[model samples]
Target: MSKFKNLVVNLSLTLGGLFMGVIIGEIGLRVASIEGYQKIGDFVDSAPTSFHTAHPDLGWKLKPGASGEWKGEGASFVRVNSNGLRDDREHTKAKPPNTLRVAVLGDSFTEAIHVPVEQTFWSKLERKLGNCAAVKGRKNVEVLNLGVQGYGTGQQLMMLRKKVWDYNPDIVVLAFFTGNDVINNSPKLEYDLYRPFFVYNASGKLVPDMSFRKLAPLDRNQRAVSFVDRLPSWLVNNSRILQVAKKADLDLKKRQISKDFTVLRANNFNPPKDAVWDNAWRVTEDLIVTMRNEVVQKNADFLLVVVGDPIQVNRDPQRRNKFMQENKIQDLFYPDKRLEKLGNREGFRVLTLAEQFKGYTEKFQVCVHGFDNSVPCGGHWNEIGHRLASIKISQNLCQQLKQSQLPKR
Candidate 1:
């Protein structure tokens, strides 16, 4: 009985020592490297460190080597909030009183990621529109950007209804991107690379995915798992691991999954093309109609700007097929010429860079937008592409505002 008591005491001491050691080690690790610890909401806030001091409007990290007060390396424009919205309380010549406030909505392209505040298309348009003296004093054209990365037409419309409409804007600009917008609508496991999970019910009310909500409770556990996941990505991404993993994943997916573009494209892929495209289009149309009705209710002007992806804008036709082959990705509902035709027929003001900047890359592999010649790293337009898009959009907006002044026949 004495021996048994001794053994129990020893065991308890060992377990206590182990627990204390773990606690001490965790505390030491936390204090030793501040950079190792990630703050909560860092992903949503755009900045990984110091949320309080960070600019609320510019959440995402700009490109490397970005400079200038008005512009940054990857960004195309400067976003000004209501505090900076006016020069004075009375409004300046640039921003006059009673001027029509214009709100631009879209994804990263419209947001002008990695660029400076002034270089964004919206900023350029504001500058151009400010030059008009006829309505300059009488009215001001304030352009507000409510763009979030990875947002689709449906999300943008929802944002407008929830946030943008309250600003009392006279005109709303809907900048539509062709790449990945359709794919973004479906449910998926991946969150960091795309927008978080959200579902629109039959009543059209947006709701957070229940699974996502459940995951939130397990954030600490997930964080620990993420650390492990990052280990493989870090080592492999830097060395032979990445190559091996990439090859293995590709080979496995190829052998296991059917190579049908339409089949493997979306999360929900059983439906026919007409059903899929029609459903997406219907959702988009409903959102637009909802916005239009809201606009009428609030007496605002509505304009749709259809922006194309580099792949779609290039209109090479072969590019989509090539992409599918290279990435082992299915084309899905997009790359369908019929969809593009339908978008146009539905009165969407289509602005394709391929059509806008044709034959400009004879000597160099320059995109229509005139930035450095490189295929997009992640499926988004580079700085130069965004700049070109902004310029074109601003020009059209200016023309539209001027036309609004002409007497109706």
Candidate 2:
């Protein structure tokens, strides 16, 4: 009887200890989260709206006929056409005659739902193009924003293959975000697990698949949440410990990324003569080549527009250097140079937004991609940034066309 009683007592004590430890740990996490945790676990409830609808082939898309006031960091009135783009007007699959149609394909930067519709870079460019064409006595010009947030080049290529040609564009502008797009091209990158990924073949060929080489891997990691991520918002918002751990986890992942993939060296900004870098380059280049050929087949002029990362072009030299140090980068625009070189070799025109943004930033003393203080850098181009991008693209396109007409002078 005494033994039984002692056993019961021991079990009770163990349960009590565990219960207390959990409570204490939770409190510790809450106390340590100085700025509070935001991107914990899956962040399922974080999206401000249901603007994106998933597609089997396209991966995801802006909902067709979705009209609402969607809010991210900033509020914007979003209206998706019947064809599922954030355009005020509907576009037909068969473009009207004398209409110079342009299609812009990219990720969130291209979609840019954070700002008002009129302020989006593509919108500004469309208006500018129209006005310019009118001045030149040319036909009507229409620029279509076919960008979807979080789209990788694979998706962009898919868009080109399956959708963009439906509009029968005269020009196709591909907005390539150099930062994440590189990793997104490789199935080995963790980001590839969430979205569709591409891989190279035994013959050193590029193939797009969301699989582990031959088989599709389980996306268990994407939907899985850590113990801390499962906590209530109030606790997470207050827990500095959890926030620190999460940041450490992110830092650790970045470190692992360097090990897993052949990343650009910060010291030289060159992709090392390694297998990972080679695979990534081949995969991405193949996609670009495929896209260019497809656009050409459709009788459209293809332009690879390289978007500069904010860290590479921040107005503050110190902050920019720190960002480079964190990423171990030296040239800052290494990816830009690498892509530009590839485009040049392949006879494709690559227009970089880095020079434009950097030049404008030098004069204004204000950032085009980010705001001041705790607001956090947007990383997406702002109104001023978008306007400049439009001008540069328009000017370059016009110049190239004129040069082509120069009769080999």
Q: Count the backbone clashes (under 3 Å) in each candidate.
A: 17, 10
Local error of candidate 2 at 148, Å?
0.8
The model with the greatest lDDT is 2
Q: Tell me the whole-model lDDT of each prediction, alpha carbons only.
A: 0.51, 0.72
- For model 2, residues 232-324, the per-residue Cα lDDT tens digits are 767666656666666666566667765544343232244644677667667788899889988888878999998887766677778877756
What value does the lDDT take at residue 62 in candidate 1?
23
Top candidate on TM-score is: 2
Q: Candidate 1 on 231-320: residue-level lDDT in tens?
A: 434454433333344455545555544344233343222233566554554555556555656666777766666565454344344664
Q: How close is every model to the real structure, measured as TM-score?
A: 0.58, 0.78
Off by over 4 Å in 1: 1-96, 131-138, 188-281, 313-321, 324-354, 357-365, 368-379
- Count residue pairs with overlapping backbones in model 2: 10
Over 4 Å off in model 2, which ranges?
Answer: 12-49, 133-135, 202-204, 210-224, 227-274, 325-327, 371-378, 404-409
